[model samples]
Target: MKILLLTPQFPYPPHQGTTLRNFNLIKGLARRHRLRLFSLLAPGDAPAGTPVTDLVEHLVTAEQPRRSMARRLRDLVSTPLPDMALRLWDPRNFDTLLEHCRAHPPDVLQIEAIEMAPYLFGLLAAGVRPPRIVYDAHNAETLLQRRAFLADVRRPRRWVGAVYSAIQTLKLRRYERRLLRSVDAAAAVSEADAAELRSMAPDLPLAIVPNGVDLSAYDPRHPYPNPYGRSGPNLVFTGKMDFRPNVDAALWFADRVLPLLHASNLGPHFWIVGKSPHPRLRRLRNRPDITITGAVPDIQPYLAHADLFVAPLLAGGGTRLKILEAMAMQKPVVSTRLGADGFPVQDGVQLALADTPARFAARCLELLQHPERAAELARRGHAFVTAHYGWEKIIPGLETLYSSNDTLTGASDRR
Candidate 1:
């Protein structure tokens, strides 16, 4: 099959969550199908070392729009479309993509997430005949926005967030319903998301093709005793630091959770590792106990040398890929229940779970103090991922989803 895969970002380097999902799925799909990857990459941000181009027959990319906060907010209220989806809207980009498709249409089009769905839909809106459409739902966007307000730590922003979330929630819900009504098939990253998509379009050809990582590259033993750098009993949290949920997690954990560890004289050091640290989160560099590594060429050493991998995520959708990477590295993970979404492992058996600051902090402390127990949990966690979460195993399911010719089972999607 000749497949055209649309993604919001270039999937190379596979350093972050969205890229990880896209890169793995695309790589796997390319094995069985001739593929053209049309991704929206921000200018000057292309990654090296990963041979992503080698996997596809053709690769196309568009410069992502960079909007200031003032303009972004203006568009948010002015447009019925949620900015989350609209951010990927580029009329010229669509023109180029549409021209290529018109000249040579593929067997199918797989729009990776909500971000890129608009591109295909836009072409259709312009009366272009689209190929068999597969809308890959990554998150229940409305639910994600709702949680952004509900899980926020700052009281002053909560009310304002609630109002904005309420508005965007309505917009995104409508957008999803209308968009799904037009797709031939759909797939989601997690069962949680798939269930939600089913509610919106009960008969859409939807499947669960989750985010995955390269198990071959991430070895617990290989990165153990990392030569990168070392400090006190280290606790590491990894993600795009500028992301709202991550920023909230860092502040909430620092202001509430990490202080508890410090008060106990545990002398535990917290390492927040990721690129593009938000200004708010960067302020924590003032503290001696916290080491904020803005961005590193590699993250394995930070995960490897850590005594405990912590995820104090208060709000987000989809499975946490960082948690998966940590567990794959055979590191004992301590996370919020939401943080550990889409995984089958038991909390105590695989890792620890805590929702509140007290519980979250306590878990970290316990894991740090008990080396033998932590090591055992890490062992089980690694085994679980090896058996279930490896890209080689999971990618086949996604490949099948791409190749599936199942007729839509429900009522006709609006033409």
Candidate 2:
């Protein structure tokens, strides 16, 4: 099959969850299908001569549009479309996509996330005949916004953010409904996400294709230098630090849970490793116990040296690829129940689970003190991810969706 994949960012390095899913899917599908990618390039992204270029038949990119805070505020009142719908809105990308379709039409148009949904909607609005379109729901956007609103409304300081999310939640529901209804089929990252999308468009054909890790790249046996040279039981939590949920999780853990660990006389060090550290996280630099490394060349070394991987996420939708990467590296994890939502692992068997700050601190302290117990959980966690969450295992489900005759024929009905 000839497939055209559209992404909100260049997926070469696969540093974060969205890119990890997009890059791996492209790699897997390239084995049997002719794949082409149309991506938006963020300011710092350099994609030329990357491995991703070798995976696809052709690649095209456009500058990701930037909207000022003033413009976004204007949009909140001026347009009914959600913030995501306008995030990557650019005429150049739409024109590029149309040019490619005319020259080398694909059998399927696979969009990565809701941020890229604008291009699909554009093609339809232009009255161009589209191929079988598959809307990949990285997160059930509406549900994600609703969760954000609920989480933020509880904190008096976050009322402004809560109000913003409340508006996006309503707008996203309407946008996602139209997107799902217009596409021939949709793919979801988890059963939890699939259920949410199903509620929006019950008749929409949806498939569950959970996010996965590249097993070879995340091998536990590979030796790495300890990124934290002077560390004493380094607790690591990694993600795009600028992301709302990650910023909130990092702050919550440092402010609420870290104090408890210190009081327990553990003398533990916390490492927040990832790109784009939010300005809000800067206050954590005052403590000598915390290290915030922004945009490291690689994350595996940090995970390799971690005494325990801690995910104190209070709010987010979709399964975390960072957790899968840590598990594949054979690291013991302690996360909130919500952090481990979509995975099917037992609390004490694969890793520890705790929701409250006190419980989370206790769990981390226990794992750090007992190497033998942590090793057992690490072994089980690695085995679980190897068996179920590898890209090789997850790609076949998507392949099945691509080959289905019903999906190909259903495009006409949506049109």
Candidate 3:
């Protein structure tokens, strides 16, 4: 099969969630298919050469114009499309796709998310007779936006953000309802997202292509020393710090939850790891217990050595890939029920689940006090992912969808 893949970002360095999925999927599909990647690069992003050169037949990158609040506001006021959709749709990207197709038309066109849908919209408007199109949904953007808006109710000061999220959600949901109906097929990162898409377009062919981890890359056997040499119990949360959900998670963990731990006579050090620390996250700098590592070359040392991996994500969608990677490393994870959404795991069997700051704090203390129980949970999580969520196992079903012409009756999962 000749596959043309479009993504919202360059999938190299595979550190963040969506990029991690894209990089691995591209790598897996390339070996069997004639694959080409058309990815977006931000103004300052270093177009790292050939991370996929070993896998892909051709690679083209479209530079997304730098973000401007003014431009976004103008688009919101002027256009009917969602601001995010408008922000990502660059006609030049379609021109690049068009140039390639004119020479060698692809067998399949797989779009990464609703963010990339406008490019396809643009192509269809141009009267292009493209091949079968697949919408690879990272998350139900409409649901994610609604969740984000509701989360702001807790932070009354962020009312503006709450309002903005409401507007975005309304626009995006309407746009997605119309757009998804046009696609030949769709693949979601989790069941939660698939459910939303199915409700919008019942006849749209959907597949649950869950997120996965590279087991060899996250081997538990690799000896990693505690980079943060503190006597207190250390908790780690890793993601792109500049991202809104991650920034919110780090702040909520530190401001609301860490105090609960401190009041109970337990000393805890929270390590917020990953690149591009948002300026707001810098505020956590004053709190001695928190250490925000802006960008780290590697996270294995932290994951291997931390007393616990905590994901207190209140808002966002899709199953967390970081959680799977930590599980592969044989680390105990404590996440909000929302944090562990869409993945199959028993609460106590695989990892601890907690929601409130007080409840979340108690669970952290329990893990710190009962090392044996934490280790048992870690063992189970590792075994579960090893058996189910490895990249090789997850990608084959997705490949089948790309190759088969048979009509899919409804959304399907490999398991």
Q: Which ten residues in a row have the lowest lDDT in candidate 3?
A: 406-415
Q: What ranges in model 3 sit over 4 Å off?
A: 43-49, 403-414
Which scores better on TM-score, 1 or 2? 2
Off by over 4 Å in 2: 404-415
Weakest 10 consecutive residues, lDDT, candidate 2?
Answer: 406-415
Clashing residue pairs in candidate 3, if any? none
Query: Per-residue CA lDDT of candidate 1, range 1-415, in tens?
Result: 8888888888877778888888887777777789898888866557444578888888877888777889879978788988787787878899889887887688888888788877877878777655577777778787788677676434775677677777888888888888889888777767777777888889777766666668877887683456336555888899998887899888888889998898778788888999899998867999988888887777888888888999988888877889889988889999998888767668899989999999898888888788898999999988877777777666555544544575332111210
lDDT of 1 at 414: 14
Instruction: Superpose all Cα atoms of candidate 1 onto the true structure and report the RMSD in Å to 1 decimal.
Output: 4.0
Superposed by TM-score, candidate 1 places the C-alpha of residue 259 at a distance from the truth, in angstroms, of 1.0
User: What digit string (tens of lDDT, one per residue) describes model 2 on residues 252-317?
Assistant: 999999999998787889999999999999999999889999999889999988899999998899
Error of 3 at 302 (Å): 1.5
TM-score for all models, in order of appearance: 0.93, 0.96, 0.95
lDDT of 1: 0.79
lDDT of 1 at 378: 95
